[model samples]
Target: MDAIEKNLLKEVAELDSLPVGAYNIRANGQLAGRNTTANIDIVTKTDKPGIDIYIRPFTKNESVHIPVILSQTGLKDLVYNDFHIGEGADVTIIAGCGIHNCGGGNAEHDGIHTFWLAKNAKLRYVEKHYGEGDGRGKQIMNPTTIVHLAEGAEMEMETTQIAGVDDTIRKTGGDLAEGASLVVKEKIMTTGDQHAVTDFNVDLNGEGCSANIVSRSVAKDESKQEFISHINGNCACAGHSECDAIIMDHASVIASPALTANSVDASLIHEAAIGKIAGEQLIKLMTLGLTEKEAEDQIVNGFLK
Candidate 1:
């Protein structure tokens, strides 16, 4: 595979050939992408930071990709993707951003995505961010997402960030209406001197609305990571938020989970935890004939999975 293809696979392994409605964005510019099925009126414009995805009611699923890379120093890019889902639709979306910077300057990608889920719709959205380089260049990404769920709508979102992101800040905001639900699962890994911050704010705005937010991360070396999560119940609803992290070396981590209930019937809760690699667990794995590094690797892989 070519460098672009290899880099694409590193973040999205389930994709082989480009799927329908695939929007490919590179460091140089945007590519003439594919057209999806007729059920969904998907459009790609040449002048935008990213693509606009429109889904008709009951339209099929969509898969999208945005990969940015630089072999030299001092490159920056910003991407924005907007999604409009019609009422009573059920769809799954696979989307992510990747970067490969091998130069001496800084390479950055700021992705701003907004989603509107119509009434009674169900959406499964997954995204991953990654960075890799052989040079001393810095890799940075800032992702801001806004979600609006209509009455009785439901959205399940999963986001992951792999290694090599030198600096990153993630922010997500969500609003839910009557009988609507939102679930978010976020995972991250940081090594070396990398720094990362993740924050989420969500509001259950209508009767019977609910939300659950979970975040997990691992920091190694002098890397630092922070997780901030908040959920608000404005009506008679149920909600919960949790944050967990593992620290190693001189790494530092902070977990902050908060929940607010404004209505008399609103039930909300939050929990957070931070810890280091257990020595006894490492010793037990070593007794199985594995080295320290190998044991640590196994533990990390499992935890992230």
Candidate 2:
């Protein structure tokens, strides 16, 4: 193993000795790296900090599952740099960002994540971005995630964003092999003058492959959110994509779902809708003796369903 990988293994061993909950690690002007057969949970806070994380299982038929959590904090811009997961590995990763700056300054974060799942492998991943109680911090987050699935592999991913006084952009893509399947769920909630854009794409490259994408967003109080979803069905594959949004009280939202079929035998479908909570529905619920707040909550809940 290289020096960086060895140093990472040592750092992880030290961290594992700590409590099981979440802990913050300061990588101030430091470089961290990990190699095969290493499972780590890391949280970084610094500027231009680098982390090279890799995971690869030992046996061919045997599967190993690794869980990872990444978080960002502080006023300076932090780069939670490149991460890679090898082929034929079962992995679950959760990555999130939170900026709690009471001052009137700005913060920025950038991340890149990549995964390669070999034949007959499975991966479940979740990503979230949230900012709370902002004072004037102009937070910018750019996250790019890519996945490659081999034959008979499966990947399920969910991404959520809640930004206040921040602007975020997220891009994700996946490539599937024969008989592979991929499912993606994206959710965004924005309030207090936030702006966000998200793009998702999936390509099926083999027969009997499938892909599905579902996107939902809620914007309120001058917040703006835009989402674009693309599903490409190639080589006699099947896929579906859907995007939906709800806007309220001077809020704005745009949703576009697109599907492209490259082969004549491929089956693909896409749908998108943008609207607000119906006042008539709320009134009907209120007439049944429910409070106004309760009625409005019910309407919002039903729309999400």
Candidate 3:
């Protein structure tokens, strides 16, 4: 990997070197590196631009890293990756994309990831998106994720958009069976004239199933952000969605949450809060030898953390 690609990997996945266990690195729309363990397999698709990962049953304490980097000008890349986790397995997946465009044309990457979890399986997935360059070209990314959980399966997802993407749209959907659970937490920050939108749709389709989705964001300068979530409970289940954001310096944010309960025993709730930083917060921080901007940044960092 080149220096640019390595830097991108660090920023997106925090990998300073080749990681142990199963891993795949994609750079400039091509596979840069790959490794697979005995219990985990990674195979490239013959008909499309993507890979499929399979984990053996009863696997535990394993991880996979699949990070994508785009450092070319005027490049448009799209990929579809799918993961099949076996029964009674527990593992972690780290995936993300970073773009460094240095030309006068737009550079964009769109990725679609689907996950299937078998009965009694558990998965922890983390994904981050970042963009940077001193160029007139725009950096754009759109990611779509779909998840299916079997009986007693569980999944926890953490997604973050760190900085510098000019435009982004994120979509996540899930379906849960009996006794299954899904939890999604997202964080995003947009500045300048960037625009960001997130959409989440989840269905709790069996008894005792549950889904929780939460998002925290900061919109600065002329950036605009929108958060939309819809959760449906088809049986005796629980669902909750929350969106919290801080608006600053002509920025705008909108949050819309909807829930549908088809069974009498289903429980659903939604919450949203959008506001600016409190003056008292800045005053308190400033009294401790910090500038106004420093105080604001500190507060924002702590809030996002």
Best by lDDT: 3
Model 2 lDDT per residue over 87-107, tens place: 556666545554444456665
Listed per model in order, the count of residue pairs whose N, CA or C atoms clash below 3 Å is: 3, 1, 0
lDDT per residue as tens, model 1, 200-238: 999889899999988888999999999988888888999
In candidate 2 the C-alpha lDDT for residue 11 amounts to 33
Residue pairs with backbone overlap in model 3: none
Off by over 4 Å in 1: 20-27, 45-48, 60-73
For each candidate in turn, the TM-score is 0.92, 0.76, 0.99
lDDT of 3 by residue, 186-273 (tens): 9999999999999999999989999999899999999999999989999999999999999999999999988998899899999999
Candidate 2 runs further than 4 Å off: 1-49, 58-88, 163-165, 288-291, 301-305
What would you estimate as the lDDT of candidate 1? 0.80
> How many clashing residue pairs are found in candidate 3?
0
